[model samples]
Target chain A: MSYSSQAIAKPYFTVAITLFAVQVLFGLIIGMQYVAINIEGIMFDTARLIHTNLLIIWLLFGFMGASYYIVPEEAEQELYNPKLAIQSLWLFLALTIITVLGYLLLPYATFAKITGNQFFPTMGREYLEQPTIIKLGIFAVLCAFTYNISMTILHGRKTIINLLLLTGIAGSTIVFIFAFYNSSNLVVAKYYRWWLIHFWFEGTWELIMEAILAYIIFKVTGNREIVEKWLYIIVAVTLTTVILGIGHHYYWIGVPEYWQWIGTLFSVFELLPFFFMLLFVFNVVNCTKCHSSNKALKLWALSTPIMAFLGAGVLGFLHTLAPINYYSHGTQITSAHGHLAFYSTYVMIVLAIISYTMPILQNNINNRIVQKLEILAFWLMTVSMSFMVLFIAVAGIMQVYIQRATDLALPFIEIQNSMMILYWLRGAGGLVFFIGVIIYIIGFFYNRHLAVD
Target chain B: MKILTKPKYIYYSSLIIFICLLLGLTIHTIIVLPERDHRDNLTPQIIQGKMVWEENNCIGCHTLLGEGAYFAPELGNIYKRRGGSHGGAYFIKAWLKAMPTNIPGRRQMPQFNLTDEELHALIAFLKWTSEINTSSWPPSEKG
Candidate 1:
C-alpha cells in the first residue's frame, strides 16, 4: 500500500496534461474558424493539423501514463525499470513535437509555394492526408510504450486488468502494423488506411475503455466481484463490436456492397456495451451511497461512462444506420460523431484519471464544496461540448437534405452561409466549455497548493 | 455445501443465433445481388471510356448512381435531364471538352488535355452511366 512521490510515472502524466491543454486550445481555434471563414486561413490549417494530431498524441500519452501508474500495482511488482519508462516518455514527447512542427511548417515550405506542380505529390496536399510520416512517428511511439508495458506485465503480476490491458496493447500493435503498408497501387493504400483509423477507434479503444470502466468501478466502490462481472460483459461486447463493427467505415469505401448491411447491423448492437457502461457507472456509483461526499469523484465516475453512451452510443447510432448514413457519411454529422465519441471515451478517460489523481495528490482537500464546484465544471464542459456536437449534427442533416437529396444546384457558399448560426452556437458552446476548463484549472492549482508534496 | 451453477446452454445458443443472423444476411446479399456484366462484355470503347473517367477522378466530383462526392451535378440522369436532340452524345462530348469555358461562376472542371481517343472513351463511359436504370432518380427532368 506504499505510494511514492518520486514515481517515474509522474512525468508521463505531466506531459499528457500539457498535450491535452494544447489540444483544447486548438479545438477552440477550430471551433472559432467554423464561425468565421475569413479569420486568417493560416489559423484554420494550423488548427486542423493540431486538433487532429494532438488527439493522437494526448490519448497515447494519457493511456501510456495510466498504464505506467496501474501496471505495477496490478503486477504486484515495481515497473521493470522506472528509468526506461522515463526515457520512453521523453522520446515520445520529442517525436510528437517534431511532427507537430513539421505539420505547421508545411504551408510555408517551398513545395507548398510551387504552383501547377503538385506539392508533396507523393503525399496529398492536405496536411491531415500526409499520413506516411505522421503514421510512422505514431507507430514508433506506440511500439515503445507497448514493448515497455508488455515487458513489465510479463515479468510482474497477472490480473483481469492486465488481460484487458494486454488486449488493448495487441490492438495498438495491429494498428501500427497497418501503418507500414504502402502499396504501389493508390486505391489499395486508401483502403488500408481506413483499417488503421477505423479499427483503432472501434477495436483497440474499446478494450482500453472497458478496462478503464472496470478500474473505476473497482476503485470507487472497493468491490472486486462486481468489477469482475462487469469486465466480462464489457469484454464480450467489445469483441462483438470490433470483429463486425468495422463495416460502418467500409460503407462509402468501394470495398464491397455487403459490408453496408453488416456494418449497420453490428454497429447497432455495438451500442450494448455503451448502454451497460452507462448503467454500470451510475448504478455502481449510486450503490456506494456516499451521499455527496466525494461528489467530484462520483461525478467524474458517473459522467465518463454516461457521456460514452449519450455521445458514442446514442448519437453514434442516430446517423450510423446505412440508409441514413448513405447521405451523411462524409458530412459534418460524421464530424459530430467523431468529436463527441472521441471526447467521451478518450478525453473522459484522461479526465477521470486526473480526477482520481487530484485527490490523491492533495489528501487534505476534504472540502465537499470545492469538489462539488469541480463537478459542476465537469458538467458545464461536458454538456456544452456534447450540445455543440448535437447542434452541428442537426446542421449536417439539414445540409444533407438541402444540398444532397434535392437538386437545387445551390452553391456551397449559400449552404455554408446558412450554417453560420449553427457554427455560432457551437462557438458559444465552446466558450462555455472553455470557461469550465478555466475554472477547473484554477481548482486544480488551488488543490495543489493545499496538497503541495 | 456450495451449489455449483449448471452451465447455461442458452447462453451458448445465443452466440449461435448471432452467427446465424450474420450468415443469413450474407446469403440474402448474395441471392439478391444483380448479375454483373463482365468487363469484356462492356465494349472496349466503353471500357476505355470508364478508364478515362477514373483517371481524371470524374466520379470524385460527379456521382453516377448516387455515388461519389456531390460537389458537382448528378451525371446519372444528365442525358435525359438535359433533354433535346442537341443533348445527345455529340453535345455531351463537346460540353465536357470545353467545360467552364462558357459558364461563369461555374466550378471549372479541370481540363485533363485528353486526346480525341480519350475524349471519345469518356463520352462512352458517360453514355454507359446514362443508360443504367435508376428508376427515376434525380427526381427531375432538368437535374
Candidate 2:
C-alpha cells in the first residue's frame, strides 16, 4: 500500500459487509411477512425499521471506507488522522448497536419519550426515525468524519474528484441538520423531509457516487483527463435536475399547483444524468486499454453504469412523470424504484469501490477464488434484485388498475389479498438476495484465511 | 475545446446558477405553504396530536401524506373516509381502541392504549391533515 493508513479501510469495509448481511436478513423477514409466511416474533414495522436503518448505516460505512482509501492516494499523503478515523468507526458502530437494541427491546413510543423526541420532535419519520440523542451522536460521528477528510484535502494536493467528494460529504452533513426541524403541519413536515432525503439521494449522494466512479474509471483505464471531463459534465447535469426536479415529489404532498408542471418537466430530465453515467463508463472502459490486472475490476466498474441506467434511469422514468406518479407514488412501484435505484446506484457503487480498493489494500491483486465468488455474488444479487423489482412493479401496476383506475374499485385490503402471489415471488427473490449477500461476505473472510496460510 | 479543457469551471458555474434558482423556488414554496396547508387550523390539540403521532411511531406502519411504510392503510385522509367528515374524531378514536382483531392470519395492529385525551388530539391533528389541499390524492377514498 502507498500509505500505511490505507489499511484502515479494511476494517470499515469489514463492518459494512457484516451490517449488509444483517440488513438482508431483515429484508427477507419483511418480504415473507408481506406474503404471510409467518415471522412469529418481529412485526413488519420493526423488521422494516431494522432493514432500512441497517441499509443506510452500512452504506455510510461503505462511503467512509471509500473516502478513507481514495483521498489518501489522490492526495499522495497519509491520512490526516487515522487514529481518530478508527475511533469514530468504533464509536459510530457501538452507538448503532445500542440504538438498534433500543428499537428491538423498548416500546418505540416509550423509547422516543425517554430519548427526548418530545423536545426535538424528529422521531418516526421514515428513515430519519432515530431518536434525538442517537441523531446527535450520528451528527458527531459525521462531523469527525468531515473534519478528518476536510483537513486531509486542505493539507494536500486537490483534484476535481477529491473536491467534489468533500463537497458531497460536507453538503450532506449540513443538510442533515434540517432533520431536527419539527413542524406541526404535516404538509410542511413532509415537504422538508424531502429536502433532507432528495438532496441526499439526488444531490449530495449523486456527487459522491459519481466522484467515486470517476476514481474507479481512472484506476482501471489510467485516463485522468477523460474521467475528470465526464465527471464534471455529469455533476453539473445532475444538480440542475436533482435540485429543480424535487418537484416530482412535491406533486402529491400538498405543496402547490405549479409543481405538477414544474416537477414533471424537471424530473423527466433526471434520466439524463444516469444515461450519461452509463455512457461514460462504457465509453471510458471500451475506448481505453484497461491497465488493471485485477480481473474483477471490469466487472464492478461496468456493472454499475449498466444497472444504474436500467434501475435509476429507465425504471425511474417509468413512473417519474406526474401523471404516472399520481397513480404510483406510494405504491410498490415507488418501492420497486427505490430498491433498484438505490441498489444500482448507491449500493453497487459502494461495492464497486470496495472491490476495487480492497485488493490494493491487501497487496494481492489476483485472488482467483475471491474473483469467482465476487462474480457469482454479483450475478446472484443483481438477477434476484431485478426479479424482486419486477414483481413489486407488477404488483403496483395491478394495484393501480384494480384499486385506483378500475371502475370496480376494490378496498385496499382486498387488493392486497388479491396480490398475494406477487408477494410470494417477491419473498422468494428476497431469499435469493439474502443468500447472495451472505456469500459476498463469506468470500472476503475466505480470502483472509488464505492470506494467513 | 473549452468543454474538454475546462469542464470544471462550467460545472461549478452551472451548479451555482441552479442552486440560486432552487433557493428562489424554495422561498416561493414557503410563502404559499401556510395557505395551502391551512396553518390557521393548527390548534394546540392538533399539534399535541402530531406529537403523539410521532411518539407512537404511527408513520412506521401507516402513511400520512403518503410518506411512510406501507404496512397499513393511508391515514392522511382517514378523517374524511372513516370519520364521515363530521364524525371523523369518533371513528378514529374507536379504530385506535380496537387492535389485534385476532383475524387468524391478518397483520395485527398493536394497541397503543392511548388515553381519551390523546385519542381526541390525534383525531384533531388528522382532521387538520385531511383539510389540507393535497391536489387530489389516493385517487379514491380506498386509501
Candidate 3:
C-alpha cells in the first residue's frame, strides 16, 4: 500500500478469494456427484470443468495481484500504467465470468460450437479447454501484465527477488503461447501441453513462490543477503530437477519408452526444492526477531513450505515412479496429488501473501479478532484438505488394487461403486474446506468499518 | 578459511552445471526420444478424429493417455482392447453409437450423436493412438 499502484492488487486479491469460494462450491458439487448424487443437467464432468478452470484462473489472479503488490515494493517505485493494470483485471474477470457461465449453461458441444472452437479446436484438453478466443484474451492480458511489471522493474532498482519474479512471469507467458499450438498428433499435443502445465507449476511458478517467500523472509527478518543466497540455491536446485521432471507426464503419453527412465530419475529429485523451502522458511523464522506483528502471516508462511513438501513432495513421490504410476495414473491418486500439491504450493502461498498484504491495505491498527479468525480458517482449511487428500489416496489405492493390480481385475464401475464411502468422506472434507474459505473471506472484511471510521 | 567464509563461486558454478544438465535433458527429450515415424504417419482421418474428440469434450469423462477425468475407462488403449485380436473397428464404432446404455446405477456416457463419418474418423484416431509407444501404461487392458 506504499504506492497508489499497489491498491490495484486489492481488487485482484478480492476477486481471487471470491473465485476461490466459487471453486470450492463447484468442488463440493463434484464431490457429491462422486457419491452418487446426480443433479439434473449438471454433470460431474461439467462441475469438474468449472472447478479446475476456476482454480487455475483464481491462481492466475493471485499471481498477478502478488506481482503487482510485490514488484512495486521491491523495486521501490510506482507501477507502470496502473490504469492498464486495472483495465486488464476487469477484462480478465469479465472473460472468466462469461466462460464459466457458458460452461454451466450450455452443453459442452454446443458451447464449443458457439465459441467458434471449430476454427482452432482446443476444447476439452484438460485445463486448456478455454476457447481460442478466451485463450487469446488470456495471452493479451498476460502480455499487458508482463509489460507493466517489466517497465516497473526497468524504471527502478533490480533485486534478485524482482528479477526472479519477472523471469517466472515472462517464462510462463512464453510457454503459454504453445497452448495455441494444438497439433493433430496426440503425442505432440500432450507433449506441448505439459510445457504449459509442468513448466508453470514445477518450473516457473516455483521461482515466483521462491521470490515471494524470499520477500516475506526479508520483510520479517530483515536479512536480505541470507534470503537472496538461499533463493539462489533453491532456484538452482529447482532448475536442476523440474526441467527434466516434465518427463513424469510423458511416461503414459504416446511418447517414447525412454521417458520411463528419464521421468522417474528427474521427478524423484523434484521434491528437493519443497524440502529446501521448508528448511529455508524455518531457518529464517528461527533466526529473525519477528518484525511483523501478524502472527497469522507467519503461520501461513511456515505452513506453506511444510504442506508443500508433504503434498507436492511426499505424495507426488509416492506415485512418480513409472511402475507405480502405471497403475495409479488417472485414478483418484492423481486427484489426491493434485489437490494437495495445488493447495499446499499455490493456494497456501497466495493466502500467505494476502495475509501479509491485506492489513497493510486496510491500515488496520488492531487486527486481533481478524487474526484469530484467519488462524482458525487456516487450520480448518489445512486439516480438511489433508483429510480430503487422505480419503482420495485411500480410494485411489483401493482402485489400483481392485481394478489394476489383481488377477481378478474388476471393471471401472464396480471399483467406483465400492469406493462410495471414501467419496462421501471426501465430500464431507470438501464441505469443511468450503466453510474454511467462507471464514477466510469473513476475516478479510472483518473490522473494515472500524478501520475506516 | 577464505573458501569456507565466501562460497559464492561454489554457488555460481553449481547453478551453471545445473543449467547445462537441464539443457542437455531438454534437447534429448525434444530431439531424440519422440518417435518420428508415428508422428509422420498420422492420417488425415486420425487428425480429424482428434479434433472431433476435442470438440466433443470426450476427455471430460474418459481418460486418454492417462490424462483427463477418471470417471470412465481410459480410451488411450480402447482401440487395442475393442479392435485388436478379439474385436475390430466395428466394435468400437458400435460402442460409440450405443453409448449411454443407461444400465441403471452405472455411470453413463452421453451419446454425442456423431455422424458415421465422425465415428469412422474417431475410430481411426483411437487406432492411431493405440499404436503409439505409451511406455507400458494402463497396467492392464482393464484400463
Report lDDT per candidate: 0.64, 0.86, 0.86
Model 2 over residues A208-270: C-alpha lDDT tens digits? 999899999998899898998888778878977888888888987888888888888987789
lDDT at position A133, candidate 2: 87
Better of 1 and 3 by lDDT: 3
- Which residue pairs collide, candidate 2? B83-B88
Candidate 2 deviation (Cα RMSD):
1.6
True C-alpha contacts between chains kept, each model in order: 0.00, 0.72, 0.66
Please give the ranking of all candidate structures by TM-score, highest first, separated by commas. Answer: 2, 3, 1
Per-residue lDDT, model 3, residue A159, is 84
Q: Report the number of the highest-TM-score candidate.
A: 2
User: Which ten-residue region of model 2 chain A has the weakest summed lDDT?
Assistant: A444-453
Q: Model 3, stretches more than 4 Å misplaced?
A: A447-453, B1-37, B83-86
The lDDT of model 2 is 0.86
TM-score of 3: 0.95
